[model samples]
Target chain A: MRRFAALVRRDLRLSLRAGTDATTAVMFFVVTVALFPLAIGPESTVLARIAAGVIWVAALLASLLSLERLFANDYEDGGLDLLALSPLPLEAAALAKVAAHWLVTGVPLILAAPVLALLLDMPAGGFAVLMASLALGTPSLSLIGAAGAALTLGARRGGVLLSLLVLPLFVPVLIFGAGAIDAALHGVAARPHLLLLGGFLAAALPLAPIAAAAAIRQALS
Target chain B: MALPDRMAYLTVAMHRFANPARFQRIATAILPWSAGLTVLLLAAGLYLGLVASPADYQQGDTVRIMYIHVPSAWMALFIYANMALASAVGFVWRHPLADLFCRAVAPVGAGFTAVCLITGSLWGEPMWGTWWVWDARLTSVLILFFLYLGYIALVNAFDDPVRGLKAGAILVLVGVVNLPIIKFSVDWWNTLHQPASVSRLGRPALDPAMLTPLMVMAAAFMAYFVTLALLRTRAELLNRRIQVLQMARGAS
Candidate 1:
């Protein structure tokens, strides 16, 4: 457990010092959200109706930005070999890396969501659920994206391939995340959507790491 | 025989049969039969479906699309399940044939899925009054099409053939596990689709006349899959051999 925490902290420190993980994803989120108004016209009603969906999609794409590099830096430099040889199991190592990723990129995206939501004229009622659903959903995105990153470590066209591999898997999260906020905006209970989002996170937490670890091992081999 | 000798013999036998030589020979024998069955069943199914089967009272002749659409959808799901199961087998045993089967059958599965989607759209335009709807079943099947494309791309993306096979196997297993979750969540998110009306577990509510051709078409699709899979696996085996030869020549 100590080793796992250390891995997470180490990743967090490195990414923070580099200022890449958090900034890139957050900036992409902002740019993507900012495009909608220009593209769809500044009609507040149009933005209001699509606000939840647009925010969720941009967050999804933003989380995808830093994914391919998740394992690339370490794998290329022999760090992954040491991790595989460590006393800490590689699955736990994978989970720790994904946790750090969620903290840096995913949390920032969640934090920036409400600002974008407001810019799009989303109702105040949706603010809480937007953040709540992102909190639950974004970890799953990072975890699944990490698995795609590991799978594509040395593959050709890694970036495009990673998106294809990861985006389809992101469907449920997008559905429920947007659904939860849409529910709140319309005065419906968001409980069921939140619960489903939680369920997705719960499933992704254990399963994705194992998959990522397996892919990592295969890449290393 | 001594224990060690027997074990050695067993291993050799296992490998011999596991190798594609034996498989090729077997496939060679069965291909004609499978091809014949495919052709026969398809002709029979088309005749019965397009001619013998009565037009639906509500949908009229347009309902005949189900004869093609339903079976293609069934094959799409069926092929994915087979790939998933084979992927697990390959992952556990490192079975070369299982890996080959998954790779060989991917395009076939993807083709079936695409057909399913296209026919569904064609049917939807007539029945649902639109070429598309965000309906749950439609969405899940569309996702299945994407999954197929992803698998095929991943299989070829790696520089190393072995790594490509292994990674593809892992991905298909992951996808199969998520298939149910995606389906359920999509269903939960919104449901404006019809319930399963026919060809269900207890008794299909379908007309007896329609059932015959649908079953025949399904059998025909299965046979078509077997024939194509065998032929493709043979090609893959040959491709691997050619790669080995080219590398060996390079080394020389």
Candidate 2:
């Protein structure tokens, strides 16, 4: 347990020191959302109308961009082989990596979303839903992306391969995340979508670690 | 042997081909038979479905689309299921044949899915008054198509084929879990698409006339799938043998 905690801390420190994952994701999220107003001609109504989709999609892409590094670097440097041999179960190590990934990527994206949301002209009412949905949704993204990242650990042209493998699965999260905010904007209950998002998170939390561990083990083998 | 005893004998005979060399021999012998069977069955099915069967009172000739559309859709789902089952076997038992089964089935499944989407659009044009809608079933099938592509991509993405197969197996299993959700997404939520008919319990809502060609076409496709899977598996085995020979020569 202490070893796992140390591994998580080590990863967090590595991510924080590099600063590429969180910074680049935030920059992409802001720049992409910023482009929407320019392309759609700065109409607040039009911007507000499409803001939910724009924000959700930009966040999706940003999350996807940083996904390749999740295990690719570790695998290349033989860190993954070490993890596999550790006293901590490979699944625990997988979870720790994903947690560190979420800290570096998912959390920063969520925190930066409100600023991006303003630039997208999302109504004040939708801000809370946007933040809430992403708060739930991005961790699910991290978990699913971890599975994809592990699966494509040493593949040729892995970035495109990872997106192709991961995006179809990400559709549900995008649907519910955007739908939750869209529902709230229309004065409807967003609870069902939120609940479904939670269900997905619960499912991914346990299942992804196992799948990722298996993929890593296979890659190492 | 009695009838039941003969059936058991046949199953064991089939399982004999589960050995790669035995499968190669059987596939070589049976390819002509399966090809002939597929042609005969498909021709009969198309004639009966497109010409002999009466038009629907409601959908008119447009309902004819169901004959092709239904079977291809069934094939799409069936092939993916086969891939998933094979993948699980490969992952759990580490069977080389199971890996071959997954690799062999993915492209065939993707082809069936592509046919499903195209025929569905053809059916929709005259019936639904649009080329497409974001209906749950349609979207799910589309996702299945992408899953097949992803599987194929991952399976070929590695320098070593074994690595690719292992990665691809993980993907297939993940997709299988999502299949049920995709199938039921329409029923559970509001969507433009209709709910289950052929898959549901009790009497299928389809008429007997419509069901006949659909079933025959479906059977023909299944036979075709088996034939193709056999052919592909043989080809993969041969490819492996050639690689082994090349490596041996280089080492020597």
Best by TM-score: 1
Q: Which candidate has the highest DockQ of all?
A: 1
Q: Give the CAPRI class of candidate 1.
A: high
Query: Model 2, range B1-252, lDDT digits (tens) per residue?
Result: 799899778556545646777777778898989888899898988898989999999889988888888888888888888888888867766778788888988899999999999999988888889999987788888999999999999999999889999999998998786688666787886876667677666799887788888888887887788788888988888887898899899999
Off by over 4 Å in 2: B1-18, B25-33
What's the true lDDT of residue B194 in model 1? Answer: 61
TM-score of chain B of each: 0.90, 0.88
- Write one digit per residue (lDDT tens) for candidate 1, span B107-133: 999999899889989988888898888
Model 2: chain A TM-score against the true structure: 0.98
The two-chain DockQ for each candidate, comma-separated, is: 0.81, 0.80
TM-scores for every candidate against the unseen true structure: 0.95, 0.94
State the lDDT of candidate 1 residue by residue for A1-221, as single tens digits. 99999999999999999997899899999999999999999999999999999999999999999998999999999999999999999999999999999999998888898899999999888999999999999999998899899999899999999999999889989999999999998899999999989998898899999999999999999
Query: All models: lDDT?
Result: 0.90, 0.88
**What are the RMSD figures for all models against the true structure?**
3.1, 3.9
- Colliding pairs, model 1: none
